[model samples]
Target chain A: MASACWGLPDAFCQFPAMDGKSLLLMRRTIDGTFRDIVRSWSGAIDAATAPLQIALNALERAFTSTPWIVVLALVLAIVWAGSRSWRIVAGTAVAMLAIGWFGLWRDTMVTLAMVSVCTAMAVVIGLPIGIAAARSDRMQRVINPVLDVMQTLPSFVYLIPVVVIFGIGKVPGMIAVVIYAVPPMIRLTNLGIRLVDAQVLEAAEAFGSSGRQKLWNVQLPLALPALMTGVNQTIMMALSMVVVASMVGVGGLGKNVLQAINNQFFTLGFLNGFALVAIAIIFDRTSQAFGQRLQQYRGAAHD
Target chain B: MTDQSVPTLEDEDEVATRPGLEIRGLYKIFGPSPSRWIGAVKAGMTKTDLNRRHGHVLGLTDISLSIPPGRITVIMGLSGSGKSTLIRHINGLIAPTAGEILFDGTDVCRMSAAELRGFRRSRTAMVFQKFALLPHRTVLENTRYGLDIRGVPRAEAERAARRWIARVGLGGYENSYPSQLSGGMQQRVGLARALATDAEILLMDEAFSALDPLIRLDMQRILLELQEELHRTIVFITHDLDEALRLGDRIAILRDGRLEQVGTGQDIVLRPANDYIAAFVHEVNRARVIRLSAVATPLAETEEAPRLALPDRLVLEEAAREMLAAGAERALVVGPRRRPLGIVRIGDLLAGMVRPSGRPPTDQAPTGPRGKP
Candidate 1:
């Protein structure tokens, strides 16, 4: 293959490429090493992930077993509380009713549970990393390229490693979703903190605020809008990853969509796809409105 | 221009008892390796030469000034003259390349990180030109920021903050966020915040420079009013000469990161240290700054006492107003306890008020009249 590509010239056009045999050998070594590591760590990993499995199961069960009307009321209440807008609440109600009418409510509920858990986990993990990156240039330099790779790499590629470690369950699906969705949360948080007014930070320092005080009292509060945006993006990315995650034996609306695609059931694919979109819009709007509400002080009348 | 009489603390025994800041031979070179160029900067290198020859910017060079306790010491300079840098050094916000900031006989430059924080929290508070209040916090919360950082109980902090808020005339605006207030009101909050800390040293870096002329005057009045009772050892930084003259008990003028002159406002206005400072003070309204005692005529052997007597501390403008109101041709310039120190006529006051041309007044006592001290 190398010779074929270099056929035009002996020097300039001949790229310094590793031959196919070496490439294949390198791939086998990496694959074998990863396999050995996963096999050795599988039991410990399962034990570590047990709590995650239990929480995800409980959330899914709660969503699915609860009466549909109660779930609708809960969601509507959350939307209203976040937005304080009657219009958004009405829109959410109509969307939830439409999903129920299509008989995809149970699947939608499962996806919601998975997305909520994934977003919570991402925020819990991403915020500190983001803050560390904001505080130190060295940390940011180390994390930036890794986050780039996490965001740009194909979602299915990482799912392979996750499944190899977790053995194809909701936990593996969740790990994959979090890995795919956490970059925005981390990046936005770092950017937000870095962009806080230097004058304000200097004032914080001038007031003799301890490191923890400065972070909690100034950086975190000021960075709340960007943090909220990160959460919103994490949720949307997690939702988008659901169908791909379903390929690894995870069940939800994503599984239904995957089945529809495999069986070439166009109506089923459209139905599940629209259900996902409706969920995305509702989550996006509510979270964005909540973020804006948090920053209402910014819009107060300026003298 | 040759006479540079920097005030010494040895003479002021009363002021020495209170904690005052003494900056000794401070040099700050801003670059990756500031220490590398400090020797050159201290020896003779100019700010431009340092920045041009080496990659380092000379922030401050060989600045040594004594801030008397219970008085306002204004560090006045144009932008990039290191006035702001000098102020930050007082609180150890920016460490010096070399030299010591002596506060209560302790070297602030040598303090550990925790020690510096403790010093800043307990001994000093700062007001910024741009009013760096937390947008998320209300006026009361912002005012209590320093106390909060020191872990003061919320109720106690709020009580102190409320008193200062009302003191700075932001009484009714405690609950309003910073964005909701005007620049003047926001700076009042900044002042209140610093004041609430009750720190002996108030570091105000151009605190009123951002306000409109009227509001700046208003803030200055409030500060002066407060200082009458508070007597904080304030180190205010300002580019405005008039503001410096009005507020500073002792003013230190900076030019290109070096001290041009350190004296009372009358000293600078009457006898500038160099041509640079002469040019700086040339635009100042002499009547407003120069006092009657600086230009008063001594009481001669055969001279009779004047009918009208005015306090020697009165500025030329105020004396002129007083003399003109009484229609007196001359007045005795009396010192403390009503001792007749000198006499000054309307002609002398008029001559003193007029701006000098081309050359600065010589180091000799101001030329118009010699007071019998």
Candidate 2:
């Protein structure tokens, strides 16, 4: 009986409150229902059609993409230059080229660019705050909470507010990457400065070092190893943010993979996924190798 | 660096040196609140009483001492005996709650920050237990650090540091980092740094303790050689009695923040001031702390000099070693000028070693300053 009353025909309830308006009001009510039905139908159609367009786009980009062999050659050059070893260079080259041949280079570069921008922003913004944190306890206290929030917030949840503010775009996606990548640098800097031996500080002071002199001469140099670790972690985190960023219009390997999944294209999805891993490995190894080189040079200089 | 030349032995003798550094009735009471009311309420309280009434740590108290010029004065104590704190007071690393620390004629506690900085930069150098070399700097750069702080030209400081590094036996290792050197070598760098400052006083806080046993002995020998040349008044802090005996011209023992005793090595070892002191020295090898002059009697016959001569300041153990090495029955005990004052017979040394009493019992030993129990 309640369903019957609630579902009564629209014509009975469309009577106007004033004279000569009932018929027009009834007709308008009928039109409103019909418009709602059409909108619903169109929304479903758009949702269904949107993913197909994305796949077609991904497919076109993948074919015209930088060839796997060419990208492999570039990677080989970098690895050989860095390590002076043909075997390691060749190995890296082969891995990257295989991912590319399997059709993943376009998505891979998208992830690469995202990681690059995020890491750059993190370094630019975090280095000074880290310096300040090292200098003052008050600044450290202020930065600590922000760092805590960035570190503890769920990865998926990072997009909610970013999406609201920037409205889904590469900028918002890049911002998300920065938010995830910055905490490590700030924390490592503060810890490195704090961990510097007190006796060293005394020696510096005895030598007549002013506050700034001590920071530059003693604190910063000693803290370099730890800070490099922070940089490495920040880069790794930005890479991890690639897939998360794609949820907000970040069209990259992550988006391509997402399109492949929606279309049930197993080979396409696997290729993109493997390429993402390969890119991550390449960056991780390179950054770590660079850090090792830095350590060796700095260690020798100190010696 | 000081404008004046380093003093020779003769000049040091003529200085009429009273106390290069004096701590008069020093006190450091660590409490949450530094209020007169709280201090008064806790006055005359025992450690337990203080702990009950207010959580406090008495790091130092009534630490009256005088480190004489051109002599090595060691403040010896175990951990928590306030030896480190006491030394820190000399340079105002920690300020005393109630007392005066007079460095030369100037009151250290009263100095303004700028004045303190000037004094510290130009006049005093400290060697920590850890070598504390800046890990980033080369040995030469580390040594130059103090001079650089003093506004010396970089070239001049580098030159000075290079000279000091060579002096400390690290001539070729100047460009090496602290990490690249052995512990002993690192300490050599620290010593070079302290010496390069050309400070009037050198404060060493167990500077050799971190080295291996063999390295420590080598460093100790090196220090004696340096002292013979430098003649700087040194205040060395250590818990090792043997080290204290070996290096200290005068030794002060601290217990629970109080000055238990202060005397020359012979005085402290032969006649400890109290039970607390006696307990501390009880197990110490007496053959190490006592000196030849301490147990030796003046020569009965002035006609002939003793067959052998030994410094009056050498430990009885060293005397015994000398006697054994030389196969001599006795050695002449000499004053600072190498003048024969007495003789140390092997029999006398053996007798001294036999009865290595912790404290001189009542009515049997000299009493006053350090001998009293």
Candidate 3:
């Protein structure tokens, strides 16, 4: 292909070939300085990141610690309340029981825990950044290019650094999932806030709503549908990371899927894949239902 | 048809001036180097020239108006005329590049962020053209929002909100959301929310512009009825000439971000300041826009015989109807307490009903000062 070159590109090929390594000379020079900066603030950084471990543990326990019957009942009740439809509740109950009967209950819960934690971390970090971008054009100018790069880059290309930095573990895997999935959260949140009607914001400002009040009462509430869509996308993206995440030692249905892929075990792959779908259905419906409920109230006023 | 009843709801009395919201020397320029060109703008540079030479858009230039309280002071213009910009300045929504806005003697532009918030929460409330009701909140909750944000107790805010909801005729739809209401009803909710705030000043930025023409008129009547009891200092913004003439106690017209003319409806219709203002007011039917007092002739010794009595504040349309109904050629235009001030001839009012094509038809300029000497 290079030889052919559409018949005339010798000069183009002969043009100065920039060494990729030389391009990063500044980074190489600053690498030690970056380490020093990290070392100097390691304690504060650790303290800040420590809550993340607790969040992970909390999600794990919330999904896994309770008795199976208790967990099943609570989950069914929530599903029932959200849908207010007996048929959907019954279908969800049967689906959950079928996965349990297949001896994949523990694996399913572990996957759920990781996805839950990743989404939580994504929302926590991404929302404020999204809001900062929405509020200030300068911030948007800084973030938009970075967000565009994050979206366009293949998610796997960033994994080498994640594994190198944090080493192979659930933490590193969670970080990777977060990096891959968090962009949507930030993007949609920024869009939602930006999309708030100009007149509404004017009214809020005219009435003397404080920045904090406007954020919570007007901007956040109005942006909820968009935010919820972001959350929904984040969850789906996180779930997609299950098999890739298992490569770093996080145990879940992803591990089983990975094993099936290695050995080409069709039945094992299909069952686990079906189980993932069942779980996805549950989470998707609930969040979408909640968003719809919010919209209904807005509609109900004029109804 | 929408304005079903003739709004004979007023007694002939002039509103005493209450200088509450005053914008003095207020100017706004859009773009990076506005300060560099503002001097040029003030030195007779055109808005188009400023944009061409320096890429700066002059929004409002040397706008000064003392908006009287207990009356609607409307800022009116065609699109790109900076009427919206001027209204926002009153509430500090848009900070002026130059000059000051004094709300009840306090400068709004100089207020600290916290002070501004407090002022916004307590002192002024605005209605929007698109019925800026919070979609998440119910009609009742939306009404309670201004008070709620100011940290009024839930029960107390709800009560005040409930009273206003009923007042705006949204009694049973308290729990209903804004999206469910029609455009007119949604604006009613907007009105209720502002009224519930109990703010001293009501800034309505083209508040009725979104409604159907009939609905808009209905909203105007409702606002007029409410203003009779609650005379909040309303600063209304509109591009519609008729709405401004109907609602504004004192009208301030803006063109190309500069104040073109400021006067009563009678003043504007009878005497437009320049060609731009003259063209703007030329199409307005004087009989419908002006009152009997504006066109009434002083009773001469020979013409002292009164055939019928009408309030001086009555529009010539109503006065004409009354005079014709009473089978009289002319009617006594009385001020307060039925005291005769002047007499209005039916022929003059009939002539007024047809707006002149390009210029005011009559040489007398009965209502406002004539443009020509």
**Interface RMSD for candidates 1 onward, in order:** 0.8, 3.2, 2.0
Top model number, lDDT: 1
Cα-based lDDT at residue B159, candidate 1? 98
Better of 1 and 3 by TM-score: 1
Task: Give lDDT per model, in order.
Answer: 0.89, 0.77, 0.83
TM-score of chain B of each: 0.85, 0.90, 0.86
**Model 3, range B117-176, lDDT digits (tens) per residue?**
898898889999998888888899899989988899999999999999999988999988
Ranking by DockQ: 1, 3, 2
Q: How large an RMSD does model 2 have?
A: 10.6
Per-residue lDDT tens digits for candidate 3, residues A1-303, read 467665666766666656778768866777667666667876875676677767777777778887778888988998877767677788789989999999888889889889888888899988999999999999999999998888788777777666655556678789989988888999899999999988888788887788898899899999999999999998898988866888887788999999999999999999999999998898788778867776776545433
lDDT of 2 by residue, B1-373 (tens): 1222233345656545534887787778777754442355336656555666677676776677888787789899998888888888887777777789888789998998788888888888989899988876788988988898888999999999999999889989887778888889989999999989999888898888888889998998899888866778899999888889888888888878888788887777667777776677678777776777788988888546667789887778888888889999878887655666788789899877765434476675544433322
Error of 2 at B320 (Å): 5.6
The total number of steric clashes, by the backbone 3 Å criterion, in model 3 comes to 7
User: To one decimal place, how large is model 1's interface RMSD in Å?
Assistant: 0.8
> What does candidate 1's lDDT look like per residue over B188-254, in tens digits?
9999999999899999999999999999999999998898667789999999999998888888888
Tell me, what's the RMSD of every candidate? 5.3, 10.6, 5.3
Error of 2 at A202 (Å): 4.7
Using alpha carbons, what is the TM-score of model 3? 0.86
| Evaluation by DockQ, superior candidate among 1 and 2 | 1
